[model samples]
Target: MINGAHVILYSHDAEADRAFLRDVLGQPHVDAGGGWLIVKLPPAEIAVHPTDAAQAHELYFLCDDVEGTVRELTARGVEFTEPVTDAGWGLLTRLRLPGGGEVGLYEARHQRATDL
Candidate 1:
């Protein structure tokens, strides 16, 4: 039986990014060793989208209210690389991580697998 998923984010500035997630985003984490913080993610689900392009994996944080979440994060000094747009499946945005990586944030219109 599967217990959980661990996601790894490669960062140019690992220390800064860890601080961002721990302080700015207020994610609960524990130091793995020597200040390698492992942040705890919220409830998650996986999906497979058929694409003709190269195979890749994407991660997104789901929210109940995209607008409210955006406002909250913005006030916390988080920079959004993209404005919220209706992506058919959800209201979507991209927030820039301190490591120069962008991750998706969205409120899904489609049924969520997390409910299962």
Candidate 2:
């Protein structure tokens, strides 16, 4: 019965961030009135990780090639906040959004739910 999921990224400068998502990342979106854009992300997967400190949720964009994706995004003016590192489960990196928030990007080495 489950249909879909909606993810929210809180931002400081939402207009600028929205522009980046639309222009730089090229995320296809629809305006939900008053210029509020709702982005359509690529196929998604979810995982639950156990933590002892606190509970939190994070979002990451999956790719087939982290290095290549990074290269393409870099050419489009995306700023990577960290170098890509092999995280055992994937090759991982973080990219800075126009609003100063960071999101993880990875090429998964493990099974992905999207394959289902």
Which ranges of candidate 2 are over 4 A from the true structure? none
Tens digit per residue, CA lDDT, model 1, 44-81 = 99988999999998889999999999999999999999
For model 1, the stretches where C-alpha displacement exceeds 4 angstroms are none
Q: Using alpha carbons, what is the TM-score of model 2?
A: 0.96
What's each prediction's TM-score?
0.95, 0.96
Give the whole-model CA lDDT for all candidates, comma-separated.
0.93, 0.94
- Which residue pairs show backbone clashes in model 1? none
**lDDT, model 2, position 53:** 85
lDDT of prediction 2 = 0.94
